[model samples]
Target: MVDGISFAIGRGEFCGILGPNGAGKTTTLKMLVGNAPPSAGKLWVMGFSIPAQARAMRRKIGIVPQSDNLDPDFSVVENLAVYGRYFGLSGREVRARIPELLKLAALEDKADARISQLSGGMKRRLSIVRALINRPELLILDEPTTGLDPQIRQNLWKLLRHLQKEGLTIILTTHYMDEAERLCQRIILMDHGRVLADQSPQALIRDSIESHVLEVHGSDLDHWVGEAPVPERIRCERIGESLFFYGERLDCLVASLDEWNGLNYAYRPANLEDVFLKLTGRELRDG
Candidate 1:
């Protein structure tokens, strides 16, 4: 249902498609990868017309899906070997790439281990290397770090960054605003099958939200908000028990923070999450 949305991603650029669930982020990715056909529109990937030459385009692109779908019955090496075969890669070529991919994924030591024997992080790393068995020019990741812990997530981030430096064009789809901020050079913010904005993460935050935010916690947030100066310019809102005040200048807020002593409050710069909420609205969307 994406409509009136048009843009281009340069070679070697890392771009993210970000939005809440049902926003068509995954649908857009599916269209680019040839899994779904556009009812009507001009679209191309890697110089090949989409859905028509979709198979041809698939040959040059690699995809890592939301879930780790590695073959549980196969060992690490076996999994990669089978995936490489799907790309028409010869056994010799696949074999040659196995060691290199293993090193790239930092899974050299677990090459022969069975899928069930590996940890979650190891399995995720293997899935990524499996996607790379064909040596793709463009890589598409759908929530690559969906369920991992912080340490493993950071480790995977390092790998993706390293790959980007090696000249791989990456298209990432994630709702995690921080993930987009850290990995993408540009972001396409989507909502209800529409492209709301397309720009760098920093640029979106700068243009959409105030420079700083004051997070007020504890009781009677409504009273605190009522006691504030002008309501419109301050841009105050309440979520659960906390209150947030957004504005370009926080001098007044900071000075009042000393007087707001009994109430737990913190002031910080606005970030990508703020920009996302600002553009998409704060209402929760059902999955």
Candidate 2:
């Protein structure tokens, strides 16, 4: 269902695709992997057109989907062994690589354990290793850390960084702004199947909106908005009982709002989440 969305990932670059729910993040990933065909426009991965060169592309890419699709009937090691076989690796080669991959995923101790016996985090780490069995030049992950604990999430981040350092181009889709900020050098923000903005996290935050945001809470947001004098450098929005004012001229905005005694305020530097909410709007996108 993705439409009119376009972006490129450079060699060895970690590019993050970010958007809220139903923002076409998953659809974009599908199109890139040739699982879904684009109704319009072109998709080129590693300079090869998608769906047309899908077989060739698959050999160059490794995908770790959002869900754990590991075979529940097999042991952790068996799963990796089977995946390696699909990539045409010999049994001896697969055996030699199994222990190393397990160790890399921190699952060497659980190699013989059935997947059903392992925890969610273990399964996630195993899935990542399985995708890498064929030594892909490009790695694609769709919301790779969803449903994992914070510690496990951090572990996955470390592993991803290690892979990126080894010259792998990584493309990931996520709703976690912090993940995008921490891992990606370049990011694409999408909403309602359209590309909203694309740039590095720091550049997007700096250029799309203000550096700092003043969050104001009060009983009557409209009353405050009506009374507050409009400043040329700032943009304000009312979300429920709060007001978000974005601008570089924070001191002036604070001075102008000093007369409003009922509103409690806090000033903080803006991040990717702020840019997302502003570009996509505050309305609840239930879809």
Candidate 3:
């Protein structure tokens, strides 16, 4: 369902694809990997035409899917060895590569441990390195840190950064705006199967949203607005019990706050999340 979208990932670039649920993010990844073929448009990966040269392209890319698909029955070493065989790697070659891969994933000490015995972070790290067994030039991660705690997510981010520094091109898809901002050199924001904005995180925030946002919360907010009207230069909206103000500068709003008591307010610079909500609307999407 990816509507006629067109963009390219340059060599060695760390790019993020961001969107809400059912924004055709997963569908787009499937097409890129050749699991789903485009009915009309053509695709070329690493200069090889897709769905036709998919077999050849497969060798050049590594994928870490949304969920862990590691073999629970196989030990860490055995799992890596088995996956290497899929790429026609020699038993000796697999043996030689296993130790270094385990070290990179920080699983060298757990080499003999069963998949079920490893912690969630350990398993995720293993999944990332497992994709590298065949030494791919490009890596695609789909919600790589979803459902993990903040500390573990940060650790994974560090690992991904290291890989990119080593010159491997990376493409990531995630619902977390902050993750995309921190890890990706560029972001492609998509919604309803079409690209909405494609730019660096800083550029997107600068171009799409106001310079500042102010949130005022309290039962008195309704009464306060009646007493003192907001300036026409600032945009204002209300959701639930809070009033939000958006503008290049919120000094007038800040100054008015002292006139009212029992009101809680937060004023800060606009961020990628602000841009996302403004462009996509605040209504929730169930799927």
Candidate 4:
């Protein structure tokens, strides 16, 4: 259901498509991989037209879907063994790569364990490694670290960075602003099947939002708003009981609010979440 959604991913580039729930990120991904045909406009990947040359195009691509589609009947090693065979790999080749993939996913110890017995994080890691059995030139990951713990997520991040260094192009979708900032060189902000904005993470933060943000906490937000001196470049908003002041010069605003009690404050550089909320609005996207 996307319209005029066009963007390019360069070789060895790690691009993140970010949005709230039901923002068409998943739809866009399916169309790109030829799992769902676009209603209009041509979609291409690595110079090959999608949904038409899908069979040929699939050979050059690897996909890690949002859900873990592991076979419950099979063991961890069996899962990779069978998937590698689908790529036309020989028995010896599949065997040789299993250990490496298991090691990379940190599932070496669970090689003989059945899918039904593994933890959520272990299953997720195995799914990612399964997608790489063919050594695809372009990798597509849909919410790759959705249910992972911080330690496991960090491990995957390091592994992804290593793969990117090997000249593998990657495209992923995520809701985490910090993940997008840490992993993506360029990003597209999407909402309701449309692109809100697209730029490098740093550029998006600098250009879309103020350079500095001042956070204030108190019981009377409206009273504070009435007494607060407004600067030309500053924009203020309330989230719960806290007030956020967005402006280029946060220090000046901090000095102006010295007389306000219970207003503990701190200034921080702009982040992707600030730009995301500014462009897409602060409404809950439940779908």
Worst 10 residues of 2 by lDDT: 219-228
In order, what lDDT does every prediction score?
A: 0.88, 0.88, 0.91, 0.87
- Summarize candidate 3's per-residue lDDT along 19-46 as a digit string, tens digits: 8888888988998988998987888888
Ranking by TM-score: 3, 1, 4, 2
Residue 204: error of model 2 in Å?
Answer: 0.9
Question: By lDDT, highest first, what's the ranking?
Answer: 3, 2, 1, 4
> Of 1 and 3, which scores higher on lDDT?
3
Candidate 4 global CA lDDT score: 0.87
- Model 4 residue runs over 4 Å out of place are 256-261
Question: What residue pairs are clashing in model 2?
Answer: none
Task: For candidate 1, write residues 117-207 as lDDT tens digits.
Answer: 9989888888887888888999999988988998998988899999999999999998888889999999999998999999999898888
In order of appearance, the predictions have TM-scores of 0.96, 0.90, 0.96, 0.94
After superposing all C-alphas onto the true structure, candidate 3 shows an RMSD in angstroms of: 1.3
lDDT of 2 at 267: 84
* Model 4 poorest ten-residue lDDT run: 219-228
Per-residue lDDT tens digits of candidate 4, residues 35-132?
99887888888889989998788877899989999999999999999999888889999999888899888888999999999988888889888999
- lDDT measured at residue 77 in model 4 versus the true structure, 0 to 100: 97
**Residue-pair clashes per candidate:** 0, 0, 0, 0
